[model samples]
Target: MSDKSIRVAVNGYGVIGKRVADAVTRQDDMQLAGIADTSVDWRLRVANQRGYRVFAATPKAHTSMSKAGIVLSGNLDDLLDEADIVVDCTPKHVATGNVALFRKRGLRFIVQGGEPHALTEHSFVAESNFDSAVGRYETRIVSCNTTSIVRTLGALKRAGLLKKARGTLLRRATDPWESHQSGIMNTLVPEQSIPSHQGPDAQSVDPDFDVVTMAVKVPETLAHLHYWNVELSRAADREEVLAAFHSSTRIAMVRLDDGLTGINSVKELMADLKRPNDNLYEVALWEDLVTIQNNELFYAYMVDNQAIVIPETIDAIRALTGLSTDSQKSIAKTNAALGIGSALY
Candidate 1:
C-alpha cells in the first residue's frame, strides 16, 4: 500500500469486469491489485502482464500472459486481504453471496451494474444517491438503462424546473449476460425487467419524481436507446426542460433530423440509424412533437441509453473512493479510443 495509491481488486473478470478493471488501473489514486476469474486462460494473461501481480490456482492463462511479458503475482485470498476496495463485477446472484463475504473480510465493495437488490442498504445512482453511498461499504450502480436515464433525470430534476417525467427504454439484450439469463440475442422482447429491484430505479433516486418505463429488445446488438417523456410538476414550457437536458454536463441530448420520421418501434429505430458501430460512445438523441390529445400531454426524447450509464459507473466508483474524475478521464478516454466499437457495440 503506497501512500499515493488505493489498492483495488476487480472480481469476476468478464466483459463488465474487464472494463471496470481497465478503468481502475488507469487512475492515479488507484492500483489494479490483480483479478480473479474462473477461466484458466484469462488468469494467465492477467498474470503475465507487466507491472501487475496476477495469481491463480491454475497456471494456464497466467503462463500465457507471463510468456507474453506481463506481471502477475498473487493468489485470490491475497487480493481479498490486500486491496483497499474490492469491485465485484460478478453476476447478480453470485454478487449477492460474494458481497457479504467481502464485507466479512472488512472490505468495501462497488457492486457492479447489475444486482441493485444486493445493495440492501447501499446507495443507487452515483450522481443522484452517492451522497448516501459514500462512507458505506456497499453500493450498486443501477442497471445500464437506469444509469443512463436516471443520471439525466437527476440532473434535470435538480435544476428545480421540472414538473413530472415519463419515459420508455429500448434496451439491448447484452446488458443481461452477467445477471439476467433469459435476455440475450432476442428481438422485440419488451418488459419492465431492469433494476432487478422491484420498482423503476429513478424514483429510488427521487421519490416525488414520477417515471414509467416500457422496455423492448431487438436482434441488433449495438446499444440501448431510451424514449423519454417529461412533464414538469409546475407548469413550464417544453423548451425549458429541453434546455435543462442540453445544459447538463453528464447527459448529451442529440439533434433529430428534420426529415426523420418518429420511430414508434425499436426495430425501425435501430435500422434507421444503421446501428452504428460505436453506438454506445455517442449519446443518441431525437426530438418528437408533444401532442395534447384527450386532455393528456405527451413528449419524448430518443437517447442512446447506454452512453451515460458506464460513465456513471465510473462516477460512482470515484465518489465512493473520493477519486477525481479529471485525473481519471484521460485513461478512460484512451480506453474508449482503443475500445472503439466491438467491445461496446
Candidate 2:
C-alpha cells in the first residue's frame, strides 16, 4: 500500500457500488480494498473481472463465484477488518445495519444516497465539506438531488443573491429492475410523506435554503430535470445568475437560445453526450426569466443537479474523515481536470 493511500471497501457491488469502486481505484491516495454483496450475477462478475477481492454474504453467491473460477475468500469480516474506509451502497433499509457493523469494528464509513433524510450530522457533499470529513468515523452523502441543489444554493448563498429556493423534480421510469432496484421509476409523485429526503438535510447546512419538490415519471430512462424558483433577497438581474452558471467549474448550464430549439428533451441531450452524468454535467441551468406577476421573483431551467453534487458528497467523505486535501480546491481541481464546465461567481 502507498503511504498516503487509504484502503476503501465498497460494501454493495451494485450499479453505484461498481462506480464507486472504479472511482476509488483511480485515486492515487486510495486503494481498492474489497467488495461485499449477496448478489451472484453480472455485478459480481464485473467486480471479479476488475481484480477486486470479493466477499459473499450468502453461500449461493460464493458457490457461483467458485464455479466461475474466482478465488476470493467468503469472509465478510476480513474485508471490514482490513480496510480503512467503507462505502455502503446498500438500499436505504439495509444500509444502517451494515454501516453500524463496520463502525462497531472501528472502521470509518461513508453512507451512499440511501442516507436518512434527516441525518444532518453527516456532511452532505464531500467536496463542499471535505475538511469536515477528516478524522470522523462516519459521514452521510445526501441523495443526488440534495447534492445538486446544495451546490447551486451554496454558490448563491456565497454570492449573497439567494433568499429562498424551491425545486420541482421531473423523474423517469425505465424498467422494473431499475425502478425496484433504483426506486422512483415510472412514477411522478408530488411531495408526500417521504418529504424531500435530501432537502431537509441540505437546509441544515444553510437555513435559508427552502426547497419544494414534485416528481413525475416518464417513459424513458434518461436523466432527471429540474425547474427552480428563487426569491432573491436582493432584486438581481438575470444576467448575474446566468453568468454564475457559465463560470461555475463544476456545473454545466446550457443556454437554450431561441435558435437552439432542437434540444427539447433530456434523451436528445443524453445522446448528444453519450454518457451518464458526463463530468458533473448532469446539471444545466438556463437563464432565469422574471415573472409577470412579480418581476423580482424569477424562474430558471435546470437539469440533473445530482451529477454535479455527487463529487461534493465524495469530498465531504474525505474531509470529515481527516483525509488529505482542502475541500473547495479539491473540487475545483477535479472539475477542471475532468474538463467539466461550470459558471461560478
Candidate 2: misplaced stretches above 4 Å?
A: 58-60, 67-73, 117-120, 174-188, 193-195, 257-282, 287-310, 336-339, 343-345
Local error of candidate 2 at 266, Å?
A: 5.8
lDDT of each: 0.56, 0.61
Model 1 TM-score (2 dp): 0.72
Candidates' TM-scores?
Answer: 0.72, 0.81
Candidate 2 lDDT score relative to the true structure: 0.61
Ten-residue region with minimum lDDT total, candidate 1: 336-345
